[model samples]
Target: MSYLKCSGMCQLIGGLLLLLLAGCSAGESKFLAGNLNAVNHTSAAINHFSVNGYGGGNVSPFGDGGGMCCVMLPRQWLPGLKLKVEWETDPNPNVRLPALGTDAYRAAYAKHKANYQQHSTIVDLPSYETESLCSLKVHFLSCNQIKLTTACMAYGQPGYPIKEPQVMKEPAVCPK
Candidate 1:
């Protein structure tokens, strides 16, 4: 019985070590590539390429390394998505991950408020950004937008409003 316990402990330690080793051996510079398209107020479609998935955080400045969340536009005049990326290391900081006023959240909150109103109980209302793009566009939707909100609200993950990757204003060790 003692031998079995010892072997089990050893196996657990070995598994943990292997996981650590794999993490270390895997380099940190992984890229996330995608294409983004947006229709402007004029009803013209614009396309942009996106990259820069690693090394984003609160400390990442606007022009240093990749941002925690950045969305670059391919053209100089194309409008980008309106998003807020927030994170907290604290055990409890009351930051609304999907910041107030997301379309999905609003819809949910509206339903919740309606149910509460029927009961005559005053549930605290959620605050939201009135100027969000949803207010301007009648029909704009993306599966990612909702998914991102759910992930952030549930897991406190940060969002990266990345622009399409572009040539570095200054060149250095760029890919050929």
Candidate 2:
């Protein structure tokens, strides 16, 4: 009957629309994201770093909140070797690292301070500049050994991207 055909067509169009909407929402989570590569020229070891930045101006006054940025460096290490880290973005233009350490904890702490000075503001979180975030150089023991480090900074909570979770309101229409 005409009624059955019309209903079937309407359901097909609705499904297609839902798929398109989901695709667009996928890109809405992060404003900027990518990897930074750090190399130890002396030992010929390489470390890959991943960085992420989130949050931008929202349309509603009560919409999501401030933004944050972070960097991750490789974990490879050596006893005598030091890292030559050129922080990607420095809040303070004057701060520079001429030397590196043996362990990762010390290196991370030291780099955090230098980066804070270059990119962060003393006043407010939302107003801080996101571009000054820097990449780090991870040291390694030997040519064959490699360690990958991952660090993430989020502008909002873990569930930010999926603002509204879908609810199953109706069951699928199945043949009896």
- In angstroms, give how far residue 64 of model 2 lies from its true place: 38
Expressed as tens digits, the lDDT of each residue in 1-91 for candidate 1 is 6655657779999999999999988864332222222211111111111222222322111112122233322221223433332221121
**Per-model RMSD to reference:** 20.6, 24.0
Q: Against the true structure, whose lDDT is highest?
A: 2
Lowest-sum lDDT 10-residue window in model 1: 116-125
**Candidate 2 Cα outliers beyond 4 Å, as residue runs:** 1-16, 19-27, 47-128, 131-176
Output the lDDT of residue 116, model 1: 21
Report the C-alpha lDDT of model 2 over 89-130, residue by residue, as the tens digit.
222334344456747657765775554321111111122234
Q: Which parts of model 1 are misplaced by more than 4 Å?
A: 1-4, 12-26, 32-41, 44-176
